[model samples]
Target: MASEKMEGPSAPAVRRDPYEVLSVSRDSSDQEIKSAYRKLALKYHPDKNVSNPEASELFKEVAYSYSILSDPDKRRHYDTAGFEALEHGAMDMEIDLSNLGTVNTMFAALFSKLGVPIKTTVSATILEEALNGTVTVRPLPLGASFSGKVDKQSAHFFGVTINEQQAQSGIVIRVSSSAQSKFKLLYFEQEANGGYGLALQEDSEKTGKATSAGMYFLHFQVYRMDSAVNALAMAKDPDAAFFKRLEGLQPCEVSELKSGTHIFAVYGDNFFKPASYTIEAMCAKSYEDTTQKLMEIEAQILTKRNDLRQFETEYRKALTQFQEVTNRYSVEKQAVDELLNQREQIHSSFTTVRTVAGHIGASNGGGGSKAHLDDSRTESQSDDGSSDGKDKSNKKRWFNLNLNRSDKKL
Candidate 1:
């Protein structure tokens, strides 16, 4: 029966000889070759062996062999260049095997110029894992946290704006950095009318606990979304006399800012450990309302901190217990090693005694009576049994001791 199409290159591919596939000798005669192809083709023809993909493939393979062997030039090419000669020609051919009407017609392209099929198969397990969501791909080189003191760095400046048409809702912008992370925040704002505005911009560089003290820098600007770009431009050239024309544009220091679309950038620095900060925006009816919301958020944050502390305490307790157990194991192992040494000594002593007894017995007479020899053997056997029993008892004692210590440690 024709087999299924040999599952293609789905399995790991191994190079196979075309000559072997055709089962023809290198020196086979042209007539001998035509006879071989005709016989195989009749048996494996897709029409005759319906539903058999393997038979179809075998049919194609045989036709390929016959085409090359029938022509002197192609046969010579195959003989000189090997199967690669077929692959080279196959790349240029666009012939479709399924449309060929008969075995004779199929022989022209099906064998000599068949399309090259992709031979790789993906593992089902990997595909299933991906579908199950167990696969994780990290496109970023590193996570958010960075190590060692970082220099002045800037992130992509994202523009945030407040709608002037909806001026009833004031805007609150907050920037914060990690504690002891040595990062600080600086900000500036500009008006929509091409005028710079005062900002709660603070000194950007911070160190130690001072980092948290200057965590956030707030700013208020005229209600224009693109004011962020103007503010950035002014900050870039703060000494420019043209920027000086914007009256009342000097940086303003305030604990709170008025409602407006404000744009600001943060500058962070540290001697060790890279620094990162978060920027946030909120809309409220008044500055007091924003402060109240901030108070409520801080309370929630405090609760989270308490939970983290509790977890840390539990971790410490577990670690201490582990250390204690490890120490006890080490002590017990040392004791067991000593006991093993004692047992070895006992075995050595018994072996020596047995050897000495055997020598003495031999010296007593040319050959002691069988009855006397039997008694001596019986005594030696009894001594051996007693020693073995003692050794077993010692093992049990150590085993129980070791278990008791381990249980107490646990």
Candidate 2:
């Protein structure tokens, strides 16, 4: 498939830089890069920057960059080829950027070069034209043969006559099917009409009646219709001047028969008993024309079968590869999902720890304020000078105990 598509006129187009659009360095880790993308995305989001075409365009660019960078395979591709590599995969599995206007033209061209086939349906009309044709016969000099009607139980005879003037130049003759003929040729004899001389002889070598429809062989001969010698005796004798002793089934030819009036006799058997069979003589060119057409049709059929088999083999191979790729994509997507979840968990935990630390610091500050208030109260009360020292020592002990506990907890 790839080889076939490569025969097209042009290759796929290249793509622009995704990393530059996202404003991230190639070495940026996933978290830092994604954080930067979020800040840029919010600033340029179409909703936030309504009626701003530049911001809207920037938003689209940011989204595209983030999408590819977020995927491991896509990121690897972008890193390796700086965005051009995304065009090389099959079309069905990707977002067809061609459907998007303007800047997407490059993507469409890129996909075409990747050997992605443009599918088309073959119409029935076109298929019919490919599979069918008519045979045409070219003009040739008309010739004579024999004509007769035969049935299941009997042989038939026809006397053929050709112009004596044309006798020297031999002609081709055909005995072919005429309306509803079922006769399967067994033998043919051309002899003078005067004989009742044929005697039945049983030969074990002869097969029984046909069980299927097909061509059966016949021996052809010719005899002058005016000859007096017994026709059957002439046919029985090997030395008899026979037409050619040729063999054929109906709708076919025997080559080179002399031009003269002659008695032609045919003997054949049939499978299904039909009412009657007609044999008509015709020019051999007609037979040859249809024969060549039939051979061509057979060759075409063989070629079509081979093509269908090859298509089936290629389809199966493509399906297998597609399945494998899909499975890999699924696994990679799952891993990315897991990583995102873990990142969220870590972020949430960090936020919780910061909130707790802030609360602890506020509590410590409140405890220190209360200690300063108590010291001021003791200094004010110390004018009596009786338990001032003891009170100061007690206050110091209480403050130290609370501070020690708070420090331990921290």
lDDT of 2: 0.43
Candidate 2 residues 1-410, lDDT tens each? 01112221222122235567667788888655665665576566544565686875565556556656755557897667554465432111222221234555445445433533221111122212222321111222345333445443244544546554444333333334444343333212222343221211110111233111212111222211111122222344444324212210112223244565433333332222432333344443345555455557545654654565576578668879999999999999999999999999888876667888887887777787667788888777886664677877888899999999999999
Cα-based TM-score, every candidate: 0.25, 0.22
- Per-candidate Cα lDDT values, in order, are 0.45, 0.43
**Which of the numbered candidates is closest to the native, going by highest lDDT?**
1
| Ten contiguous residues with the weakest lDDT in model 2 | 197-206
* Steric clashes per prediction: 9, 2
Model 1: residues with Cα > 4 Å off, grouped in runs: 1-185, 188-257, 260-302, 352-410
RMSD (Å) per prediction: 35.5, 37.2
TM-score of 1: 0.25
Off by over 4 Å in 2: 1-148, 161-179, 185-254, 259-263, 266-268, 271-275, 282-410
